[model samples]
Target: MNDAEVLMNPNDLVQFLKKNPEYFTKDDILRFCEENHVEMVNFRYAGGDGKLKTLNFAVSSKEQLDTILSEGERVDGSKLFSFIEADSSDLYVIPRYGTAFMDPFAEAKTLNILCSYYDGNGHPLASSPEHILRQAEASFKKHTGMEFKCLGELEYYIISKEETFYHRSNRIGYHESGPFCRFCEMRTEAMLMIARAGGKIKYGHAEAGSFTKDGYYYEQHEIEFLLTSPILAVEQILIAKWILRRLSVKYEVEVSFAPKIAIDRSGSGLHIHLLAEKNGTNVLIKEGKLSDTAKRMIVGILDISDAATGFGNTVPTSYLRLVPNQNAPTYICWGEQNRSVVVRVPLGWVDGVDMAADANFGLKRRSEKATRQTLEFRVADGSACIYEMIACLICGAIHGLGMNGALTKADELYASRNIFNEECTSFLKTLRRLPISCTESADALISKRKLLERDDIFPPGVIDDQAAKLRAYNDSCLSERLRRDETLFTECAEQYLHIN
Candidate 1:
């Protein structure tokens, strides 16, 4: 069967597992592999910097499959980050069967499974980004008896292969279909590929940003995902990125996830919409209004908004996007339908609003009730590690939920003003500004280590290592600017103009 057919009828595998009792056994996997003509399998994992790394092996026989299943592949963990020393750098990769999918971009028939990292002694790697997110997921569920669901609106820019000299106006690319949207067909194919790989894609569209320079025209676009469990969301994000990257190569285009590609242009953002559910009810919405827990979560996020910037906006270029009047958030605040705040509660129909008056009313209400109750975190950019970013957000919410008074104060202070306005600047001055640079954000993260390190969610020393890396990156950028005799803005644009 084709990949789509196989994924569509997942019950075939489910029934096989039910009959076998011991699913993913060497024999079972070999049988399936043979039937599917899977010549190779790749074990994939997230490295320290959240980049996906892989180890591929030919799976021509049952022996190979058995060997792979019984003896997981060893990797040099020290190379990944500060996870291990060279003397004892051994790590293991254990494949997750549920994540296995046919590689749509592979030249030959291949299967890819996302792997979990384990230490030399067979213990879970605490420094692993996936592990950190898993722990956070468990902790959040244990403490609140609720499932955390997340939907991501990932924005990126597609650059043309042929260079052009004409510079287009800024902020004019939103939903501009037809001739200007060169990569729309590729995006549609990517969405289909994502679905075949078990990802839920809500929609894809051109975003509000386009510019031409050095014979290349950069057009921004976004693909949004349906709400799913935290772990699934992370997995889907990785898969989506993989699809985009592979497809870009085929299309002779460059896809950049960088927050700000130009000095004076709209930057890409990864706006996360979060929801919490208890039993069968949406905990984020109570009686058609924001719940106390939801309010606290928002307050908690804003409380450590400066520190949290390190998690979402990791690169030096990320801060360039956060200026006032841009689509990016510049201040630590929340407001309904305000894109200028760190967190935005989009205005939609009330729970019981009439569908006749508004076409979107029923859809909005159904989404709130069944899919999610909304809070859009607008601060995060494309540079973030997906797992780490979500974990930090969850931790911040936990911290915020415990401080009722602080939450109340934050709600009173920020739930109304449009911080982008001149009138609100004075009020914004009272609230903390998100760190303006990578170094400053790293320092904030170091200061708030306690908040993120609670319950061992962050591996010991991982935060320190990440902070040091950020500082080094900042130092390198500074030195490069000085060496080139270029201003910081020009240097930033040069370094990040094509970065993915």
Candidate 2:
């Protein structure tokens, strides 16, 4: 048996290092490696392009393992992100103990941990995504006295060459099982690994996107994570993508989190469900209705959705997924269970109707008071700089909190029914439309960046760099060009199939 497979405690793979869990420390990490005979230490972090990068170390002694965990290592930050200049790009990558997990794909017994970057002066790198998120979180808490929490519903398509039986029809495989959902096993397996690696996982299932194009079968699946702070939420999603990519290689299949992998087909969206917590209670809902805080937050989001596109929808293909009549939103609006709007307030189990009574005839209950009500921001896709995305959101909410007429704005923009429905055409006219192209999105960002810069969370250089990247695509005419040519349209979508 390989050393990686046989551990002193096999359950450690499922558990958090098999000790005082959740609050892992340097000593705890060292102890786990020594006890489990871990041979390699891998430090991973999310790069500027929203991808995970790893630095590996071969640990032979306890001293080396302790030193690695305590002091960490240095790397050229310019390579991971284009923001920093090469002359002064050396930054320290320090392992975050709480993110430690066993690497299932490593041939040797490997311990993997996510790291945060720091400049040579020992300060958090301002350009670092995680650092920016941390600052945003702190600023929001300081002003609102509530912690911003988020959950991610990450969707992606899996492509396989085999034309097997029970092929599902396009856009009809939601929550499917068995033969109908060909990739259920792999999906569950991915969820298991993600959970074991400190991800606050909710569930995994087949999504409503399946297609057979050009002799290759493309099916969609989603892995959603439970609510956590913005920092950990982003890390879990990035780590999940890394695990998916690793498994894809072993399965000899291709995977993509791209917004639009196929023209006129269902596009994958990284829908982010947001909430604010105070004293361990959700403040987004009060007495079964949207709270003032929630309303203000929604208005804030709508106010900045166009400019925020530079952060959420980074790729040119992102706009391709946001057309009207599709599940994606083309206008800025919010409503309860309204898919036509950018923000959807899905059913939140807030009825207090004991759901467990249906499963068990007689069951004891306690004072259950954890609210699942959240505002789902549906615009963000896979091709996003998640840190910047959440930071802008936090800033927007902060600004809305202070705005005198935010509540009125929310009421004015609320859609009782699907705005895209024929009957509501006149009402939809009142709502402002979100940007539809990379060029338009960048233009909005540059024009209205003050919303994101309210708390100095996003440095001007950061926003400018993002805007510059979007403008480089010059996609103002991309939609029209793709609409006219079928081959060019599909080819364009396929190229950006896996920007994550």
Candidate 3:
């Protein structure tokens, strides 16, 4: 038989990894490649925009493996925005062994390993998004002896070309089933695929925005994941998006994770929930109340709400979804169960009840002590890179934790009531609103660069580069709008009404 026909099965490799967790050494990989007749390996990494970049190489001998593991594969760093200048564009892709997985979709039997970017001298790139996130995690650990556990509620719209025959209004698709929920089977299959690929899927369901017309149908859906380490959570977000995009093409549908797909429709959001933990215990809760550290972190995020949006809400269309009373927060405030505020401490947990009512009654009571108290930051959308958003959040929390008594006062005032209510109008006058436009948000990031850049969490010039890029993007959008219709700039409110 030929060498290819005598090679070990990819499934066998997966099982081998599961059985022997210590098989991550270079020697082990080389041995496996030699014995299994493996032909190629793929190295992947995330760019500044969270898009995946890949490098592939043949794995014929042990010499090549040793060279790659020791020196890494060089790549063109200039391809990624803000990474490097054309004069010194050389960077290396060093594989992160823990992120190794077999490519189920590849035509050949290949192993895909996620990698990190490093400079020519083997130093980690400061402008690298993954590196920034790792530094943030390290900083948080240094200050509090705790790590962050994060979960993402990723929402998106799926449009199909198949005919629906009958039509429905654009505003009623929440928890939909049967004929109206045309994408149920597809979403379920995607969720299963994600689970099989090592992602922890919490749930998937239809959202509250959909419409059916002529021979096309558009529906909103959400896929929420369970809490995990910050790095793993971010990696899973990228993986989930990759799965969805691939499946969408297979199903003959178009998927959009844009913050706002239509002018007057429910916008998608990438709401993130986080908890601080130490020694396997959630540190955000103590005696059924928010711990001092938790309060400080929340207040810190609130203090830098506008600046943080530059990373979380990166695109001009993101601001269109932040209108008041549209299930999107517009004010710089926090409150329990208040969706109108930038930060929300969801209800049920505060009253000793789980927010997930579908759990078994007995099991719910049994796991009460294990329940974690989390803070949900609701401003970010899919336009932002997960790494950048989390890094900005950690920086803000660090600043907040070191603030004086003013942070406490802001929290107390915001938690008193719904800040958007008519009765709270007088109080709202004293509070700041989130940036009204992408330009303003970029300016906020520049103004608050010192606060975010402390301790090298964000390398020098990183914030400036981010702000310049955002400004250029906003300018492009504005120019396009002006060319389409001269009155678009003057009548933006009427053109992009908040209907959700």
Off by over 4 Å in 2: 1-22, 169-171
Cα error, candidate 3, residue 180 (Å): 2.5
lDDT for model 2, please. 0.84
Ranking by TM-score: 2, 1, 3
Q: Highest TM-score: which candidate?
A: 2
Q: Encode model 1's per-residue lDDT on 273-370: one tens digit a residue.
A: 88777896667777777788788888887777777777788887787788788877876888888888888888645665556547765443333334
lDDT of each: 0.76, 0.84, 0.75
Model 2 lDDT per residue over 167-269, tens place:
6656488898988888888888888878767777888889989888778888899999989999989989998999998998888898899998877788899
RMSD of each: 4.2, 3.6, 5.9
Model 2 residue 496 distance off true place after TM-score fit, in angstroms: 0.7
Count clashes in each candidate, considering only residues at least 3 apart in sequence or on different chains. 3, 0, 0
For model 2, give the RMSD to the true fold: 3.6
- Residue 116 error, candidate 3, Å: 0.4
Model 3: how far residue 291 lies from native, Å: 2.5
Error (Å) of candidate 2 at residue 287 is 1.9
